[model samples]
Target: MSAQLPEITFDEYLNEQLINSLNLQTNVIQNLAQYSRHISFQLVDIKNDVEILANRVIALHQQQQSQFLPPLQMFVQPSIPPSNSLCFFPPAMQVFPPLHKPFFSTTPDLPNKPVPFSFSTIEP
Candidate 1:
């Protein structure tokens, strides 16, 4: 013999559905609150990073400016390098080898010579 299930009333079914929906909404609200807190923490970290970077940039700029005055003298007399003697480029007094003519001449009247690549004079 088959056993029959008890029938639930319409009002009882509606109350059950409402309770389930309220539970779901409560869980969603709790999850949303947790996410908001996490985002707030991340924002705080980003703000701190930005502040630290700004301070470092300011310090570096000040250091560069303090040392810039010595280099101003080099402009007047290019023969004298900066106080540190670390030149950024070839000194004005250094002579560069003359640029060699290209092997292929556009004009027939000009003869071209092959130039060898040399770095004998440049110090490492």
Candidate 2:
């Protein structure tokens, strides 16, 4: 059997409408918060992947530069110009000084004077 209840007044109806509006607004705010959290998580994952890719790209660029760079070349023989050859006088003037032979030779021209040498000091 249905029980008789008192009719809701105009003030109570207005209050009920206000409460429903407030509940709907709260539900909307909660849904927006959940969506923002989901977006943040996705952004975090994307950031990590980007960082890894950036590091890999840097390593690859370094490797490429190393491979393309040329090694320092060293010459086996020293390449000296003809003018750099050692001489007592300048060749452009072409002046020849009188040659004086050394007083001593392999035959020992100063045998009587006796050339002082370390050979005499070295004991056999």
Local accuracy by lDDT, each model: 0.60, 0.59
Model 2 spans > 4 angstroms off: 1-5, 71-124
Model 1 compared with the native: what TM-score?
0.53
Q: Please, what are the lDDT tens digits per residue for candidate 2 over residues 75-108?
A: 3333334675665343434444323333224323
The 10-residue segment with the lowest total lDDT in model 1: 109-118
Global CA lDDT computed for model 1? 0.60
lDDT of 1 at 25: 100
Which numbered prediction scores highest in TM-score against the true structure?
A: 1
TM-score of each: 0.53, 0.50
Please state every model's RMSD to the true fold in angstroms: 21.7, 30.8
At residue 54, what lDDT does model 1 achieve? 50
Q: Taking the tens digit of each residue's C-alpha lDDT, what string does model 1 give over 1-124?
A: 9999999999999999999999999999999999999999998888777666655654554454455544223232355555776565556656444243323355232212322223343489
